[model samples]
Target: MATLAEKFGLRKASGVGEAGWGHTLIVALVSLIYFLPVLMIIFTAFKPSAQALSVPPTLSPTSLFGLIPDQFVFTPTLENFGQVFNRVMVSGSAAEPTGFDVFFFNSFFISSVSVLLALVIGTLASYGFSRYPLKGNDTYLFIILTTRMLPAIVVIIPIILMFRTVGLSGSYLGIIMLYTAFNLAFTIWMMKSFFDELSYDVEDAARIDGSSEIKVFMKICLPQVVAGLAATFVFGLILTWNEFLFALLLTGVDTRTVPVAMNQAVSSGGRGTDWTLLASIETLFLIPVFLVTFFLQNHLLRGVTFGTVKR
Candidate 1:
């Protein structure tokens, strides 16, 4: 009888061990190369503003001429983070809340609301497409997908004109609607695949047992696709959170998001770009995305593979 490792295909072939080690090393190196920029941003965020832009671009926080006398340690300050939130002192007085607070709130609110709307609408549409046959359904799906394929720039001018005509320009509702529309295509396509993978027996049985269509869909179908919903929510959140072009063109000062704020935060009144503060903003900006992905990582793994295997 074969061992469990062989049965599961987990055992390495006898001649390939050295080659596998080489491949692993190559992958590790490539991953580090891609991660270096993120490491740079994190390092710069903690450094003093002067050292952040220092010549020769040292990654170490300490200098040879430091007070600690060549020790590799330097004090990391929260001043950069404070500056991001407008908490830094101004001429010995405490600073007031600048628009950064508003920017942060706007980003959170818009991204959350838009993703929720997209998920709700897209999930329903996807279920209909998966379970209910319509004439020219594939053609309709292809048409919806074509909207995503078009470059945003190609549509922006017309969308802007339409929004202005409808008095939707610079409004939260307008941006949210736009984001929902953009995300809807992706959500539907992704969720439809998951729904297609489900067995129809359960749904059919529920229907035969006097369950209404709404009750069967709500209580039975939706529960089984939780993984897909989590995955779709994360993707939709990311698409809206990092979007800059639409927000920049469509939103006013009152509704600008963090990506727009990051652009404004880069310059400091003709004193060149404030690299440290920008790094601070980027570091904070990554937290919500990171947290969401971290929490849903297991669901994401299952979601992406949900339909690939057959029992």
Candidate 2:
């Protein structure tokens, strides 16, 4: 009887240990799955052209001794990143010059200008919607949202023609206008929700103190909705920075946006199809977005919810 009891106790301990080990293994596998793409991009970015195109894509391998051995070969080089930054010389218009310096400035200028314009205009539009509440306002809101739902590609040709007629084609103004229109719906809707959460009494109190409408908005409502504005600005900035379709179709040479330039680079297909270079460019592109979010992450979350509650 004593021997049987000991065997039973040992079996139960082994079963519990195995279950715990299995759970840990599952968690480690899930983490690896999430991290694999990031690892691949980083690895690919530094691979030499020949190795980059090599069949079976040697990402990671360990030797028999459980170490990455020197004999376990891989070609590594920074030339791909160099090419992405600036190509020495490539003939033809499609193979035109590409410099991170050029496209970065264009992207920054267009995105900043567009976001500023949208914030100003969209805020005013949202305030009006919240304050007035006139008949057909619901219809108007629907119309605004509907604008964003339209296929941007479908209208690109017409917009290009319109810009040409007005001498705005390929110009900064043309791109800004195109972006602002597309982004307006989201900004207005988001801002309106934030505005709706604020008490009407606060504005009424300001007016009673003889504050002008503009003054009230500037001094009172503006402070209350600063978080919403920040959120909107970030959203708008991301949209404009990453926009490719309109930038590609609308802008020419000097005015081309980063994504457009990147697309042009790949499409031209000389050293253009180089995935290592593509990976480096993508890394550069993503860094700004990552930094902005990382730096202001706390402020953004807090600001977006300032006037959200009814109290």
Candidate 3:
């Protein structure tokens, strides 16, 4: 009878002409190592506190042989999720709203608004740059890239002062505009590359057919770069989602994002961190990001590689 390994063509080094399996094994091992922390997070978030902090760390062993605790069969509970959702927004007030809900909304609103702004402003700028061929074009692009490359801390003080002058500090509008402005340069550069790769013959033909410029752009050019739009949109979303320094410095209590909230939760009191609660919030926080990546997976690959190769 064929062995278990034999059925799937798993082989030993004894073969005369077969390729070695060592590389495959190494890759698999590295992959497992990389996922170990995530596995621990999943295991910890669902387990009860006792189980989550078990000595020598049970790894969620549920069943026991003689003294062995089996890890696979523990009952799951939604208490941690409930705790996160039910956290008091105002600690010392009569009207105690839920904190996580507000933070979640802020994160969503900021990311979404910033994405839209980047798309509109960046796409237009990219299209203009692609079509206009301005003098010192490379220098202009380099300058734009420099803005994105600079650290948030470098400009935080000046921005705060600027915001204070216009009454924009610690407001949702402030953070939204900040995120949009921060990502705008990268978006323009990326979308410009996509535009540069496109042929202008179709747009020219549309214009010669008496189509308006907007119509030509909407009908002929925009459709060709859907992948770029999706990729750039996703990048914008990620940048806003993960942005910490500016969010921390610029956000008021009402406008705090999930990342800031999570940091506050972990950094609260300074006694120690709540690993269980932290893990739960973090896992839930990542759901939207994961969903975005999953839904946009198809376009991301193609768009990210837009100008890399010629057809």
Please give the range of 10 consecutive residues that has the lowest summed lDDT in model 3: 8-17
The TM-score that candidate 2 achieves is 0.76
In lDDT terms, how accurate is model 2? 0.77
TM-score of each: 0.84, 0.76, 0.80
Task: Write one digit per residue (lDDT tens) for candidate 2, span 1-311.
Answer: 34432433333333434457789999899999998887777777777767776766666533446565544446667777778866755455343346667787888888888888888899999999998887989899998898677787886878888888998888888888878887788889999998988878888989999999999899989888877887888887888889888898888787888898877776674654767777777777777767876776655645433334467
Per-residue alpha-carbon lDDT of model 3 for 86-170, expressed as tens digits? 6544457453334889999999999999988989999999998998878988888888888667677887889988988998878
List candidate 3 stretches off by more than 4 Å. Answer: 1-29, 60-75, 87-98, 269-271, 302-311
Q: In the order shown, what is each candidate's alpha-carbon RMSD?
A: 5.2, 11.0, 7.5
Preferred candidate (TM-score higher): 1 or 3? 1
Model 3, position 168, has a per-residue lDDT of 85
Q: Candidate 3 at residue 86, lDDT?
A: 66
The alpha-carbon deviation from the true structure for residue 53 of candidate 3, after best TM-score superposition, in angstroms, is: 3.3
| Candidate 1 global lDDT | 0.85
For model 1, residues 108-179, the per-residue Cα lDDT tens digits are: 999999999999999999999999968999998998898889899888999999999999999999999999
Instruction: Check candidate 1 and list the clashing pairs.
Output: none
lDDT of 2 at 62: 39
Q: Which of 1 and 2 is ahead in TM-score? A: 1
CA lDDT scores, all candidates in order: 0.85, 0.77, 0.79
